[model samples]
Target chain A: MTISQAGSYPSSKGIKISTVDTKEVLCGTALIKRGFAHMQKHGVIMDVTNVEQAQIAEDAGAVAVMVLDKLPYDVRHAGGVARTASVKVIQSILDSVSIPIMAKCRIGHSSEASILEEIGVDMVDESEVLSPADENRHIWKWNYTTPFVNGAKNLGEALRRIEEGAAMIRTKGEPGTGDVSQAVAHIRMVNNEIKKIKGIYDNNDDQELIRISREIQSSFEIVKETGKLGRLPVVNFAAGGISTPADAALLMKLGCDGIFVGSGIFKAEDPLERAKAVVIATTYFDDPKTVLEAQKMIDEKKSMLGLDTKNLDLKMQERGPTI
Target chain B: MNNELLIGVLGLQGDIEENIKATTNALKEMNLKGKVLSVRYPEEIMKIDGLIIPGGESTVMGLLIAIKNGLLDAITKILQEGLPVMGTCAGMIVLAKKSYDKIVGNKRQLLLGVLDIEVERNSFGRQYDSFESKLNISGIGNDYKGIFIRAPTVISVGPQVEILSKFDEKIVAVKQENIIGTSFHPELSGDYRMHRLFIQLVTNWKDANKGHQNF
Candidate 1:
């Protein structure tokens, strides 16, 4: 671990810092937040609606399960107000599963996040899939003890979310669509932007760095940090619209730290088999043979009917603040 | 000890890279020669001088091991043959001889049962309840920040095990011969003292086992 002076900035947001011996140990700081996200690396986090589905996900070797009221597909189909999962259901799933249980809250909904935190949900996704509570501004996540994960389509959005204290990042591909193209594009875009910043940092072009930071609407420190790290400050997982084991593997191969299946698993013909296969594929993403074995475990005909991202009336990826 | 040692971090899931980086840094700080590898397949367990089971979901780690044929057996056999191993948090639970949920009955999960201890899962509550504390660990000096994230606690231990540290009168760390288990993650703590100690254990074990056939 490269122990950077993460919370060294003089901000009133209360970045807690504690020193142990000569070593500067960060507690309730960036390390704790990023460390929590790091635990989910190279694994699969499945989305499930209820206790039974959560149990099946646990049984399928998922690192964690995301608990939500409705599958993203159903949420889109219903065309009504989408909200957080029920307290009763979340508690029951928490009791039933040994792995971490993550729940989604509407973008900028701090009260829902507080309730989830009180209920002891492991992590909160300030997800765009849910109707945005306040589209103009996101919650100041640094105020809360619980870590929040936000979605981004490109580098500026990712840094903005990270600046707001999101411990993790996921590409906000069109949710409810089984398509992986938008996710692929989003990750590539983020990677290219990172590469551009890294070039500026490497050249020691202070003026250019400032210009780029302004363009991204993030502080010079965070943009510089992202350049130095050559990646997002937190774990970046590929989410939204992943349905198959191959899709999971592709994301892993494309530099995603992990995989998230939203509407993909439950909507599949064989949820258990598909869930297990995706997990396997993700763990052994670098190995073609194992990926092939995982591919054989699921039937292509049983996959969800994917939506075309080009024709979506509701684009979750575009919901959050652009700058 | 050999000129260059090879250490493996069990890479089925969870914080594998963090452990690898920490181990590499520990090796460099001690001015020792070693390489850290992420060991995913069961057969790779035999090639490492030592092993580290990182923090993740114990249920997922155990289940993944059980899914792959001979993985559990492979790890258990090598650990018994005295390959120094350190398990942190979820890793600690996986190494325990027995495990139970704090709120409910015994958990039906795959544990290697190498460490002669009983661990209570989620004894520190959920992620929100997770915290960091300074500990006076034996031999490593004091004020080492111990980060517990949805961590577990050792409920009981056998005679062979030595308690290393504790918090609120509960066991948080243990050492038994070649095995070391901590309910908190040393890799995430930013203090490499614990990793250094584990590396020292690995060096000692390698020196003692010289040309043993199992190694």
Candidate 2:
């Protein structure tokens, strides 16, 4: 009963204490923000434009709702400078749902992020779904307490975003395409790169490891950690072009920590049923029967007609920092 | 035979992995034989000697546990049966008997209601107001760094609940029998002292109950 009793278990592990005195706990450490992201694992984050849509998302079992001024597809067609949702719109959705509300801020738009933080949004997305505010720079995320989720297409992109203090990372698949192929391609690229890093680490190729870290524009420490863990040090979700339960399930199976559905739910005829189905699919992604059951919840003909990613003019995936 | 303690972290939502890592590190540091598992179902509750409810969005976590998974009753039963449980942040809110969101007003939701205390959600205001400070916990070692992230504040406690720690004269931690609740996230603090204390409590509880029943 008391831990004083001697046992056969190994006691060789020595205790290590962190010597660094943390003067400021800062909004949340990368680890703490990553911890928050972990809470959303196995859950769905739906994008909503209004209070009603927010309620539908919540009622459909969405763990969180991303507040947006326009759906990604609408933004694509309207062709204007996309920015953070207005404070009034965000406040209305915040008032409507008990679940956490996340809002999108344009890439490198720290001012927009600050405003969203000021208005009390739970999380901010340095979203590729919105127009790039700055071509060469990203929001120095460490300056804010609200965690930021950024999009990445490959390991280097993912690592660069993490280096920039992104608490969460998602694949920058072509949004509004209703196509899962690009998302699949991005995730696979990241995964393959991770596997290669792990192989190099296993082979004890320190020189190659350093080279990869440089190529990725990330710290060697984080790069090595990712190699050892065989996954991104932070939570990675799949986003863009995910329009169905099956699409969500596919990404989840492909090793995403979670799935983000923008323009997928509300754009559908039955947002309620589609959202709920996507949530179920995410929760039971590995089980084909469960995914099939979830898939049965929707009417494909009534779903939003998705564009092919190949024909898209603006490539949001290629918009961020190139490292 | 080795008496290895098994700790379960509620994995339904919130900082599940971080708590697991912290607990694992704590067990190693204390030279305790234990394994930490992330518990997602009602049945997993029976397999562990202690539990941790991590910080996360309380409403979503509550909805999943109390409604979607129907584990609230099961959790309450275990707490009454003397399961040593520690809840941090939103976890603390979930364990309390009464809780209110300061920004959202007096709308109360379903909680575990095990700890007899009142909690005001986001007592430190918004994410912008979050801060970290070293404080003296009543029983733990001195200068424990507490990480407050949109943290809740313990406004009141029942006669039986003991105040463990405070920040800026605000209630931040409390203990009632085998249950422990902290408004700030100890798991995120990179310190294992709190978890070590919980493990010690679990060991003592196990020792006391050895002859009474098998856990």
Candidate 3:
């Protein structure tokens, strides 16, 4: 909430301002977005975008949780479109927690966001790429008040999103897998391309989005070589293959605002316990005291969704969630 | 007694302060007196001259609003009272009489749906999908630098609603009597003219209210 002359708070990557009079509570590392209420006053952001996991994350000190479009167990089983399966799962997560819930719409699923609006999730992340028609065809971020935190592979893509209106940025982890290479590439790209812009993107330019993405793609090699996140286009967070607190900590060292633990928690041995531990790792990335304390709290509880819920379940996933 | 005029900012979610800054600055420029306050309490609706709903994530705000003190009922009352409300981006969605689909529709979509329009959330795309344009506002005269970030698009407008601006034939701005809705961020552009126009609405309301009070 500390706005400068431009009416925005400065971030390592971009401006962090709030519409609510409520301050960002960043004096020390309080988290935000994944069931934010329980966050242990660490400014280190801990954003849990998955709903079933959000409940556990919220209980375990997540500053905020994101309510994303979940890959339905049924849809995964039946092999259909990533159909909206656990719509109510997200709603239940939102209903249960006071922290922000980030609702995601896959690339080109703008209509899906409308349902999220009705469901009342907090933020959004358009994670998946559009179908060839949308991605190859290209679709831009629309205007929204929910400060959007987008994923970029490099500085240019980050800038493109910022230039187009992204308030925050994260390195795009080549989704649907645990590949950290894409995440690494994104960091390199952002660090290399940091010096190229002044203001965030606020226009609808096709060339700009692609150009930025290219920069991000190119810098992946450089970032890997340097082993550092150079300069993010906005407040940078890391995603893709982050499962453990130690993994979360490594990305933070690599320069991320937070880490999006996608399949990490829900797929963990103990979701609730690991959710707490991840929250600790995200905010206390640099602080050993907090990290150790969070580690002690880890109680390895079996994650609810079994192997049957794992990917390649086209039928069960298509069957959708009864919840 | 002179009825005090007030402006309400949809404190539901998002940038309530930005609108407060612009609106307060513009009102000051117009030689008018008002207060910019955070409206977690819906009862504040009764004391304002007008309402300004700032831009932010509408989904979060719409969902969280019910839990924020007594804001829900206050918004419902203000709209029913015919209080002038202006919405920008996410604010526009909150002000619409209907929207594409929302999260908690069963408990009733927490929309104060007062305006005669259907607003689609994130219609413009994601943050990376965002774009800016030189929007030619109908009544505001000058082409304001429109800042649309994760903005919405008006899918359908009620007959009473007037389409104010468009980009590539997409409806981005609209107006209906006292309610002014747009898909872009005007305050972000440092333009006080729109605030002035809204103030004019407040002033006119003051004048009309004065006449009614006397009678």
TM-score of each: 0.95, 0.86, 0.48
> Which stretches of candidate 2 lie above 4 Å from their native place?
A1-39, A95-98, A217-222, A280-303, A320-323, B67-70, B211-215
* TM-score of candidate 2 chain B vs. the reference: 0.94
- Looking at candidate 3 chain A, the ten consecutive residues that score lowest on lDDT are A25-34
The residue pairs that clash in candidate 1, if any, are none
C-alpha RMSD over true interface residues, each candidate: 4.0, 6.8, 13.3
Q: Write down the lDDT that model 2 would get.
A: 0.80
DockQ of each candidate, alpha-carbon based: 0.46, 0.24, 0.02
**Whose DockQ is greatest here?**
1
The most accurate candidate by lDDT is 1
lDDT of 1 by residue, A29-61 (tens): 656666778888888999889989998998888
- Better-scoring candidate (TM-score), 1 or 2: 1
TM-score of chain A of 1: 0.94
